[model samples]
Target: MNTEAEVREEMGYSESNSHRLFSVEEYYTSYGKIPKLCKFLGNNIIILWLIVKANKDMHQLVYQKMDCPELLQEAVELLKETSGVGEDVSATIHDSKIKLNEICRVIKEVYEVVAKGICMLGKLCMHERFLSLKV
Candidate 1:
């Protein structure tokens, strides 16, 4: 897997260089650990757009919160090992409030099939995680 610095060096750009202008595709394809993880997690355009629009510091904070790089690799490996079966599934998740830990557990345990179904049914193109908010 390419780290942010490697990708930046390959593309001849980095967050440190603000003078150069680049397309959204080029920008997201080249920088940041979170952007790299987002690409691996399905590469949804809206999510990428959100990431590009979000504050850079917030993304750094998320990386700190999630213990990134490590979490990123684990997520990619987990997704790879449990390739989606594309089964048909439907349900209403009713709750007064959903905790982040519970959401994380569901994501780790059960959302795989549901996400596959959503993609298979064309209801959603893909699943995306934007961790710009404080975790």
Candidate 2:
């Protein structure tokens, strides 16, 4: 787990403003309200795309670890139910599962994809593009 300082540094927030950020509990509380959040982002394609990419990256990480199948499954289910598409989401979940079943998968692939996704999100946030979206 990253230390608070490490997390702050990675997010490029100074120590003085770190205290204004959400705590773990607050973060989880926000996560728990994702259905509403999804509704809120209904008109924001860019932010929605970022979320989908992040979810895909997370699925890759979970697949590489093979240690949190339940969590991954739940995430896929949530994505399917909230994405406003039944058949396509099912197909996507199936494809992701098939990839996860590959015999010689490399962990580095997951790391690279996740890192790239995070970098993209960071850039978007840095430019205030994410904040400018209608929600």
Candidate 3:
């Protein structure tokens, strides 16, 4: 468990704004709204990704390195519409199970993209460190 000060430091917040850190009692009081908050965030991919990044216990959004298939599909469809990923996804039927393969394929694709992005960020950080040492 992270102390409030550690969390604030990781987020790059100044000590003067420490009031933003919520107490455990406050979290317990607001716990009942979590379900509604999740429902609201369901369609928001950027926010969902931020939650996945910020949460230490991320099993609620991702378990065993996989997002929920239905949620993943929804995110893919939203991206297709907004980012022009091109055309509606056709269902791939197998063993009389419709769209199962499509869901699996999308999940794999998302995992690859996320892995590559993390790798790129790691390389970028190392490059920056190397350059700083040369100064």
Candidate 4:
């Protein structure tokens, strides 16, 4: 499992970079952790997409969230694993996740799959963190 901090550090990425995960308002706010977590989770999903692309067997069973066609379950799972806030974020990310049984044959489709996953997760990140806000 990749910890958010570990992933960021190993990638030579700091919060200050242009791709800085969040704005100043977010960094200091109570709900900020969710956005940062989403970035890490989404990055990991993108990495997983690459890994899945290279492998044959593993690509067949790409886990996706229910309902939404473009979203991947991995991003939600990543947040659950890394942030300790499972339910709310997953609910937000898993709006539409369609299954792809044969990823290799449709190799070119991986980019779109990944792009949709990224977009869904971005939407999730932008949503107000209900759990953190409650806390």
Clashes of each: 0, 0, 0, 4
In model 3, which regions exceed 4 Å deviation?
1-40, 43-101
lDDT of each residue in 69-117, candidate 4, tens digit only: 3335646644444443333334434656423533322443444455556
Pairs with steric clashes in candidate 1: none
Candidate with the larger TM-score of 3 and 4: 3
- Which regions of candidate 4 deviate over 4 angstroms? 1-105, 128-131
* Top lDDT hit: 3
User: Against the hidden true structure, what lDDT does model 2 obtain?
Assistant: 0.46
Cα displacement (Å) at residue 95, model 1: 10
Candidate that beats the other on lDDT, 3 or 4, i.e. the better one: 3
The TM-score of predicted model 1 comes to 0.23
- Tens digits of lDDT, candidate 2, 1-135: 445576456555567544444354423213444454334434434455667779878865321222256446645544544443344335546655645434223333443445555544444454454346534
lDDT score at residue 8, model 4, on the 0-100 scale: 60
Clashing pairs in 4: 68-95, 68-96, 68-97, 69-96
lDDT of each: 0.44, 0.46, 0.48, 0.47
lDDT of 3 by residue, 84-110 (tens): 212213334334454766766655566
